[model samples]
Target chain A: MNTKPKILIVDDKPENLKALRKVLKDLDIELVEATSGNDALKATLCHDFVLALLDIQMPGMDGYELAGILREEEKTAHLPFIFISAVYTDNLNVFKGYENGAFSFITKPFQPEILINKVKFFIDKHQQEVALYELNEELKNANKELDAFTYSVSHDLRAPLRAVNGYAEMLNEDYGTHLDDEGKRLIENINYYAKKMGALIDDLLAFSRLGRKEIQVSEIDMNEMVEGVLIEMNKSITHNAKIKIGKLHQVNADYGLLHQVMFNLISNAIKYSSKKEHPIIEISSNEKNGKIVFSIKDNGAGFNMKYADKLFGVFQRLHSQEEFEGTGVGLAIVQRVISKHKGNVWAEGNINEGATFNFSLT
Target chain B: MDYEVEILIVEDNMSDAEMTIRALKKNNLTNKLLHLKDGAEALDFIFARENYSDRKIENIPKVILLDLKMPKVNGIQVLQELKSDERTKKIPVVILTSSKEDPDIQECYCLGANSYVVKPVQFEMFVKVVSELGLYWMILNQPPK
Candidate 1:
């Protein structure tokens, strides 16, 4: 009776309770018995029950009144109640039972098979509701935990990375002459990887921040952003080639995020073109379908179109490590930036000819 | 051609420290070498007297090699501490790190790191940096003696 189901069986005769238990024992259910309506009402108040089998005839509180009281209480109101009256199956009794929150009626000389099936239906449905309720709460808590963890990573992880890079650089300058060529290069690589890892962390943080940061859409000058990106790009891109600056159009977008988009697209053009014989980079933007479309084309080691779907995936690189150098997050960041601005990004390329990236802001 | 440098090398990794020392030595400037592991140890070495009570305060190495990533004290905090210290206040601290992260480089300079150098991964390049640093800090420039 006090098992998993937490069922409340109310009947004046103990014989009826014993009979119901014998029939439902095979099903994994807990049965609780109350001889009178008063006892049933008291039991429902203290414990959660999947279903209550109420006896219509009772001494102090009648089944209808008790059921009405249970229905008034928010806690036990939704519990499925089955009324047992022994009184003939009359329309008035059934209508009143229905009005008082009785799910259905069961005659005193109950059919064991029919009762078992009906009780099983309600019990299974109740278990499902409970499972769903618990799952929702668990999911909410997990999301909150994840948010806190990301915040810690955004701040704490960077301190150590900075230290690794700072001291390594000092070693290079203060001890350069004393080291052999290979020795110097080793430290430089360490410095490089540390920087690479640092960029990875920053990109991850930026992507996470994008979810919450308010996107302030304003008119943005793509030409100016492109030029600024070019200046920054010049610092790291070890490439010598002809870069043609096309006419850029202004767009209604988040200025900072759009700048990031342009920077990523343009620099990617230069990086992929590092090995090109005549590396030519073209930047142009236009209004397409009422959206500002920006494109960056480059003559470089292009990727196969079959793998095009993976282009914007975080840390997804199609090329071998020896062929290209990057954190593989540039395109992903660009995608995020554009997506945040209510835009779309796509890439077109062949194996060796070149690659062209296009994005639009709406 | 000689120079006495108040140099601070802050480095966390030991192998890098040894390599840096080797490079500086090869450049013929091994008379002064101060190696501190983490930021906390570096601060204690430079600021607290009882920390390095066994060593002479006057003979503090002209250059301090500082590593940024350490358990307690990190490179930036150490730089801030050194710049603020009267005794080792003017010492030229160079940041040598394995990271090419821009913010790390920018922050080091902002915190008064004298020079920022990215450690090259290849052995040959690392040796070149070490030698250049030795030549620059030891033989080329003179510090306030």
Candidate 2:
């Protein structure tokens, strides 16, 4: 890898190219010189130049024409140029040079300091852009690796978990008469933990799988969706909470993902507020700041405000497993789904008071 | 190699194969079951080549419970080879693997797999799934003669 930045200097006169080289000699760069416009185009093909210094008074192809041709090429389209002109030093000619996409214009008998400063600016800008491009490529590769890891976990990790659970069940089934009560209890514990681990792996896979799933947007009736969630929850859970649902606005979003979001939020609200006597749960939506903000508020064991930021993180739980039986992936999944839709999710809570989970869809 | 086979299970994982056999045994469906270790061996046995050269190729199993991920050759390749062959094309192949990936499922179906079932992690669910699959394929399904 050539770490030194390349600069192309083009002029009709060899002396002029020499003068530009003498000016840029102090800078740490590789200079490629061309005496004609055609040669400059050829030089661009050979090297990825950070900046091009062009003389405007060439015979066959002038500086402006060369710059225009360079701009047309995809590789050199964004290449910055310093236009040097002895003939077109006037305001009109300078304006024409600027129209031809000149980064900086220098009149002939140009000061060495001025040329060096302008060359240095573009080189710095090019270096910054290169750094940013490298960073972006690294991030893309990292995301790909994470997805592959999650995929393997989904496929390979569950096999061992299934084996553990299966053998324990076989032991219990085949030798239940021979084993004592304590031995049977131990086998049961093994099965229980294996099942719990299986659930955790399933939740983790679901969360990671969301990253790769493409969003298919459609107009969803929020009222109907919430009603469906409530009906399903009522069937599965025995909760005595007083539920209230306000008019939810219809929004364009992925149906399956949004349904999951609603399910997670509403379920969290119900579970957290289950211990409260006469627990009150409210589900509402309204348009604010050109976004439909839907909220699920519950009067339950509200978390401390200090740890609110940690609520949506994967496996991040403010409450222990004893207080709430959860895998802690629900909110993380909610955040991922909402963010993928280009929306925002947040929560407000205080100790012993209540918690309100809100999300906005555009 | 010479025994009467009704169900052929091609699975590389010993534990998984054992559990599957136990599940089938519980339902009295393992009497004529044959378990091959990998796709290569399964292919050899089905084509009546290599070690099982004495077996007749015309004696096809009623159901082949195939695992997707295996050494030498995978389930998709096995499904492709079987479905493309005239003699083995009629045999029902049920893809039993741990992968629930959409692409894998789609590819299996595209390769002419009769069924695709994700292996459940829970022991009881695994047992139930295996037994039900055995009962359905052995009893309910009428194979082409």
Candidate 3:
């Protein structure tokens, strides 16, 4: 039923065709034999074959003419062929066989094992190529689905969240004095939680966007980027945090993406250590193994080492939302941005001992 | 005499429109502000066509606050029509919506949007934003003759 592997062998002599058939009879393969080049071309149209064995010397239509015909047809253009001939085994003829797309050639007194091994190699290669093509099609479909998901998250989800926050604020601003203390507190909680959900949605959108966004690499000044981020953070974080900036080196990266990485790391450091009378955060960089490694060490609420692997995962939190106000997507975004830059990121921490986050770029 | 409509807010969400109007009222700017439900109504109001034929076409609003995603028509289409027409091209347009997608931002400006503001999730911040926008577009910015 055409399920079995097929091979075509063509020759002008009956004895030669018999020998070729006898050699391949042991294998579970269908063998089609042709006595002339025209007959070989006709046989190829009827059955799909893994390999073709062609005789260089033939009657009206020779092996080269048959191979050229098969190559012209779109269906058999990539069909593998091996030339077998007793008369045209000279250098010029053999070179012509190769130029016509013969994968390998077998002479009249060729070894049986040599013919079998060459056929097997082409069969395996064709199978691998088919599998790779299927995999690529699947990847393209998956990316299309991901794009749709990111759009829904960015537009559909945020629209309702904005309404919830907006109306609640309106209620509180217009009717706060009319309500009792408990009523006022309840409205405040509602607004706070709504804003929290909005923050989570924003983080999710950012994380998904990194999947499709292109990264533009440039030379970034580490010192200037860190200074700017710290200044921005200070406006929101009113803690007695003592930040120390060590000797930092310039890096080759996407400026905006790497800037987000620095912002996330330094913000985490400051947040986890806000309880201390004087929160100490240190930033440093060094050259290692032809790559620049930067580290941010903070004396804050550290985590257990057992869950270290979950640190970079989306929505993975080492501390409760109450202890640290974050959507847990900070580290996940940091990891994704660094990985897109072809870099590595990891962290080390211990409970109540503070945590150190490190990333490297080459 | 033709009525002067200083601010035109094109928003589909009722609560958002109410909140925006309240913020403008807090600054005593709601006296001449007009809120339409969607881009279609806003277009009708500005061009003095269909239901708005009684309104004078010369009395254009000082600024248009457009939202991107709407039911009948959208902000981009409205902006395109406004910027292409000679009578309405000189009026300023501000795109205010929840979408922060980069493509939307680029497209809005390409369609002649004067400014783009992503709505903040915090109510207090939203109130502050609306008030500032009203002040800037209604009082500060000058329109073409």
| Best by the TM-score measure | 2
| lDDT accuracy of residue A292 in candidate 2 | 93
Q: How does each model score on TM-score?
A: 0.50, 0.87, 0.76
Model 1, C-alpha of B85: deviation from truth (Å): 4.5
lDDT of 1 by residue, A97-170 (tens): 99987898887577888888889899889878888988999997886677567655754565556557656766
What lDDT does model 3 reach?
A: 0.87
Between candidates 2 and 3, the one scoring higher on DockQ is 2
Model 2 residue B76 CA deviation (Å) reads 2.8
Off by over 4 Å in 2: A34-39, A56-69, A89-102, A177-185, A213-258, A283-294, A338-345, A359-362
lDDT of 3 at A286: 90
Q: Rank the candidates by lDDT, best first.
A: 2, 3, 1
Candidate number that wins on TM-score, 1 or 3: 3
Expressed as tens digits, the lDDT of each residue in A76-118 for candidate 3 is: 8999999998887788988988899888887868888887778
Which residue segments of model 1 deviate by more than 4 Å?
A1-220, A224-246, A252-260, A263-282, A297-306, A319-327, A348-356, B1-10, B38-51, B76-85, B98-125, B139-142
Clashes of each: 80, 0, 0
Highest DockQ: give the candidate number: 2
Could you tell which candidate, 1 or 2, scores higher by DockQ? 2
Prediction 3: B-chain TM-score: 0.95
